[model samples]
Target chain A: MSYKAITLKKRPETVISEDLFDVVELNQPDLLDGQVLVKLSHLSLDPAMRGWMSPDENSYIPPVKLGDVMRASGVGDIVESKNEQFPVGTRVMGLMGLTEYAVSDGSNLNIVPKEIPQEAILSVVALPGVTAYHGLFEVLKPQKGQTIAITAAAGSVGSLVGQMAKNLGLTVIGVAGTNEKCQWLTEELGFDHALNYKADDFQNQLTNASSNGIDLFFENTGGTAQAPIFNAMNAHGRIAVCGLIAEYNKTEASAGPSWVGIIKKRLNIQGFTMPDHFHKFPEYGKALGQMLMKGELKYRAHTLEGINSATSGINLLFSGENKGKLIVKL
Target chain B: MSYKAITLKKRPETVISEDLFDVVELNQPDLLDGQVLVKLSHLSLDPAMRGWMSPDENSYIPPVKLGDVMRASGVGDIVESKNEQFPVGTRVMGLMGLTEYAVSDGSNLNIVPKEIPQEAILSVVALPGVTAYHGLFEVLKPQKGQTIAITAAAGSVGSLVGQMAKNLGLTVIGVAGTNEKCQWLTEELGFDHALNYKADDFQNQLTNASSNGIDLFFENTGGTAQAPIFNAMNAHGRIAVCGLIAEYNKTEASAGPSWVGIIKKRLNIQGFTMPDHFHKFPEYGKALGQMLMKGELKYRAHTLEGINSATSGINLLFSGENKGKLIVKL
Candidate 1:
């Protein structure tokens, strides 16, 4: 049998283009002993994928080598399995590549229940959701009545962070690229305020919205947009650095302020990747799933049909073209 | 009776000069109800004093207003007291300005035992010691066998941080401005390694000294010196942002490298001030005091005599002229 896969053609210096990947046909090999053949149905597109594409950057995960399958989190079904634990027809999620089929020994795979929707499994119950959970609870540790300002407020992680913070009684202020995204954050996600970072009055809006000052900053995007928010942080503020999508595509390094605020405000800035906290994902996923089932947690996914579209679909994240969780359906 | 005091004549934009202060003699006033008359014997000179002199910078304490006594931590003898808790001739320490006499309402004062040397009270038992304590114990949380790097490692806070970290069984690497300071750190303070940041091969030295990568960075001096250290941090590294003495004297803000390391290494950068953690002082002081008396912990105080020399003494801190805990003996 033949399966479709996308391989990294060349590492880009700055902004990623569709040309960086090549869509190719590969022969599907028979499952070896204790191995399961997973027919992937969905692939997760994330901002961190940009970091993984860099040849020189050191990250939590190893960089994708040239001519190798692009690294991604994906959900699929075990079509054929020699492993008793993961029998045929069992649904699983893991660090499967951007491919139509995968061969797994079940090392990193997690069993996903049939009841959970594929979109949620690819989003709120997967990488983005678990990232939001760990970064918020473990890193930021928001308190009741504290104000939290989240950047990339409409993205997969930021959107869930705003909702969860609101649910936990934190006043949520969001910063996003567009007015539409900002509107969705405040109007739909129950955020106290949302400022379009692209707007001329962004600084004023941010200042006014966070009059009480931000107690916690969920930093998803790092660039010039962070300066005003950093200036508005109260004493002893916590900043959970989940991703820096704003600087991901830039050739030159972004300029930050004097950082005197870090001392004056006594802020705690912690950067984290979800994989490091995978041990807690099961508990996080169970809680997040329960919330979703009871309608207490809400999430959105922007899916691009077909695995072939992943090249263009992934760029949507860098260009801010897609709202919510960007995913590819194979 | 009259005593000399240094008042902020004007705020300096960068490097502090003697001209910013005016030495004036003021008549000692009668104590009001609940007030204690403190005759300051030793005044603490700190890098954070430069920040307090900045008119526009945000700080834990309000800036020392123009014409007001310059904000400083001092050890003194309460010659007169209306408060029953603090008897006459009782030694005390607090934000008793750079002066020969101060009348306080006893709001921020801490009673110091006569057995504790005035130099220890001004250096190890006071702000600098407390800052090193909280920053290491609470923020960095260093573990045995971890490699700890400290900037300005011969100065007040950094010196103590090195000794404490060494006592705790961590490999301590010290970064200082001069060879003499570096020698003192490794030879006297028991740091595993010491590098002169001003040396031509500083970067190579830092790389070789910290080949295992720094686990905890007790950041005292900030600016360009941080770039190499930031790059050499291990995964899950912690940085305690105690002070930016390097930038304190710079007219233009120093350019820092892309903070990609903060994310790439999952570094936790926490900035703090001692005043904010005053509640932890008693416990910290008791432990530190015990260590000092038993000779388990070593510290040095470079005292400049006479209250009038405070103008020059403070400048020594920016010039890196003072080797250890810079203090003014009034």
Candidate 2:
């Protein structure tokens, strides 16, 4: 029997395009003594994938090797198993990659509850949830009643961050690219204020939205919104740099504001990635699951059908076209 | 009796020109009960003075008020005392302003050892030493084997920082604006490598100096040296933005490098000023004194004679003409 998988063909020069990947068919290997076979149901498309496609040894996580199945996390279930802990029909989630089937020796897979839909798992209990939880609660160390400004607030991780902050009694200001996304952030996600970064008066809007100045900043899209939000930070402000989706595609990323503000405000800026804290996944997943059940985390998946669409569909994230979490149904 | 002092007459629009200050002779006031009179001997000139001359509410410390004696820290002797704790002939140091004499209520002055020279006290146990200690130990938290790079490497604080890092078993690279400063850093200060930031191949020199990539960066001068040093940082790097002297005098500060490298390296950047950490001064001062007495820290005092010269002589710090610690011998 054979299944399809996407393999990284070349490194991206500037932007992600079709020539960077190749769709291939692979034969299913016989399961070893302790192996469990998982047929993936959903694949997550994230901005981090752009980094994984580039060959930078200095990056937080090592890039996916050329001629190998592209690296990714997804939801799947055990169709056949030799491991007693992971029986047949047991649903699992892990870095199962951009493939239909995976043979895991129980080291890479975690058993997940089946009642929760695949979209919910990938959206709330997977990479986006963990990234948001760590960056907000750990990196930013936000205090209740503090004003927080989040860029890319309409996207997967940003939306969760805003919701979590809002629930914790913080004054949330969300910056997005489109007014419709801004409206959705306020109307659907319950963000206090959402401003379109594309507006000519974006800085004015930011200043007005944060009358007391921002105390915490959750940076996801390091774009036009970075300077204004950074400038509006109060004394002793903290910033968590989680992602720079806006600058990843650019050959020459623009300059950030001068460090004089960093000294004047005595700000603390830290860049973090989830790979460093993978040990806390189960713990974070449990907490995130509780929040999801109580309806505290409202998630929407702008999903694509089939694994073949994964290659081109991931570009929506860089273009800021995806309305919500971008997922693939395998 | 009258004593001369420099008063802040106007805020500098850009550079710290002599017109911004007015030299005036102030009549000595009769000491009330519990008052002590200090005959100022030596005043410390630092890059931080530029910020104090401007009127910015958002600054870490309040700016000097218009029509008021300019703020500065100095070592002095208690010539007359009504306070029992500070008897006549006792030595002290505090923010006594750029003056010939100061009347203190025993609240601002800290008693100093009579054994140490006033120049050594100001250079090693005062603002410069404490700033260097706090930024290095508390902020950078450097490891013994780490490679650290410091800008303004021949200045009061930077010189101390490099020596301390070198003493602690870390490889130290010092950067400055002149060949003389760089030579002093390598030959006299025992810095492993010293590069002139103004050289045409500065970036190339930095790359050669830090072949393993820089783990710790102590930024004092945020001039052209910032980008090259920032670009040469290693993964999980830490940067302490202690000062930006180059940008302080500019009408408009230039932009910093993009934050994309911050994420790619998972870097930690923190900005700090000594005003926020004044409570630890006594502790830092004691530790610094021990290092000074043991001959582990070497400092040179570049003294300008008389109170009147202080008004114009302070510019030596901004122009990088001062060989070491800039001091006023009043």
Candidate 3:
């Protein structure tokens, strides 16, 4: 039988256009002694994909190579298994790439419960949830009553971060690109304030929202809102730089705020990606599962239909048109 | 008796000129129950003095207000004391201001050994050495066989940082402003390599010197050297922003490198000032004293005569003219 997959055709110069990828047909591989065959059901479309498409030597993980299946995190069900741990008909999730079927050696994929919807699992129990849990509790180390400003607050990781910060007794100020997203953050997720970064009086809105200056900052988007939030930080502030969605496609990334503020405020800024902390995923995933199951966390998934929609649907993330955590259904 | 001191007449706009200060004379204070009078013999002119002159609300420590004695670190001998721990003829070091005499209630000043020269005490046992120790060991948390790059390599703090990193078995690359300073770093201070930031091919020299990418960066002067060093960092690099001597005097402090590198390399950047860690002084001072006594550390002092010279001598630090740790002998 044949399966379809997307291959990285070329490295991105600026924008991640269609020319960067090629759809190809391939025969399903026979499973080896410890391997299992997974038919992908849902795939995650993330901002981190932009970094993976580029060929930066200093990137946290190696870029997806030309002529190779494009890398992605996905949920699937086992159809053929040569291993006892993951038997046939088990639902699993892992970095199974942009493909309909994958042959895994039982190393990558993990068994997940079947009762949960794929969207809920992808949005709250997979990469987004784990990233948010680690970046917040480990990196930011929030204390009760501290004010936290999070950029890209309407997106997958940012939404979870805001929810987690709120749970820790912190005042959460969420920054999004549009009014609708801002409204959703405050109304749906219980964020203290959600200001649109595009608004003219965004800085004023942020100041009014945060009566006490921001003590912790979780940076996901690096654009117009970066400097203002950086300037508003209090003494001994901590910043966690998780992603730069706005900067990924730019020819030249914008300069960060002056180091003078860093010294004066005695700030500590740390940059991280989820891959580095893979060991803690199980630990984080379990805690996040509890948060979701107990009604402490809320998530919305903007899932596109069919595998082919992934190519064009990804740009929705960059344009800030996607209303929720983006995913693709096969 | 009346003693001379320099008072900040006005806040600095750009340069630290003589017009901003006034040579004032004040009479000795009548002793209170626990108050003591110190006849300041030596003063240290450090780059951090420039930050104290600015009225930045977010500054690590409060700025020196107009009509106040200009803040500085100094070593002096106790002439009169009501406290037994710091009695008459005892030597002490603290932020005694740019003066010939100061009154203290034994709260600020700490007693030091009288045998060591006041210049040595100020250069190594006081601000410079402690600043270097805390920044290197506490903030950077360096390991053996790692590569460390330090800016302002010839300055008081940078010199001590390099020597200490050397003691830890790390390869050290020191960036300075002058060739003479560079030579002193390599030949006298035992730094593995020293590159002059003013050199046209400084980046190339740094690349050659740090064959492996920089694992730890001790940033002192944030100018031409900052971005290059930032870009040259290895995976999981650590940065300690101790000072920005080059940026402090500018009308507008320059912007730092884009945070993209921070994310790409999973870098950690921490900005620190000594006042925040005042309690650690005794602990750091003890370790530094052992290094000095055992001849593990070497220092040179550029001492200016009389209190009046302090006004003019401070500019030497900004101009990169002072060859060694700049000090005032009164």
Measured against the true structure, the TM-scores of the candidates, in listed sequence, are 0.94, 0.98, 0.99
Ranked by TM-score, the better of candidates 1 and 2 is 2
Candidate 1 has a TM-score of 0.94
lDDT score of residue A159 within candidate 2: 95
Candidates ranked by lDDT: 2, 3, 1
Ranking by DockQ: 3, 2, 1
Predicted model with the maximum lDDT: 2
Runs of candidate 1 with Cα error greater than 4 angstroms are B32-35, B55-57
Query: Where does candidate 2 stray beyond 4 Å?
Result: none
Highest-scoring model, DockQ: 3
Candidate 3 Cα deviation (angstroms), residue A262: 0.4
Where does model 1 sit among the CAPRI classes?
medium
Q: Write the per-residue lDDT of candidate 3 for residues A209-317, one digit (tens) a residue.
A: 8778999999999999999999999999999999998998899999999998999899999999999999998889889888888999999999898888888888899
Score residue B108 of candidate 3 by CA lDDT.
88
Whole-structure CA lDDT of model 1: 0.87
| Local accuracy of candidate 1 as per-residue lDDT tens digits, B1-330 | 999999999889766788999999999998888999998989998887888888653578778889999989999998999999889999989988889999999887988889979998777888888888899999999899999999988988888899999989999999998899889888888889999888889999998998788899998888657888888899999998889887877776665556667788888888988878778888988888887788877778898999988998888888889978888887
- Give the alpha carbon lDDT tens digit for every residue of B139-173 in model 2: 99999999999999999999999999999999999
Residue pairs with clashing backbones, model 3: none
In the range A1-330, model 2's lDDT, one tens digit per residue, is 999999999999998898889999999999999999999999999899999888787898889999999998899999999999999999999998999998899898878898889999999999999999999999998889999999999999999999999999999999999999999999998999999999999988998999999999999998889998999999999999999988999999989999999999999999999999999999999999999999899999998999999999989999999989999997
lDDT at residue B279 of model 2 (Cα atoms)? 94
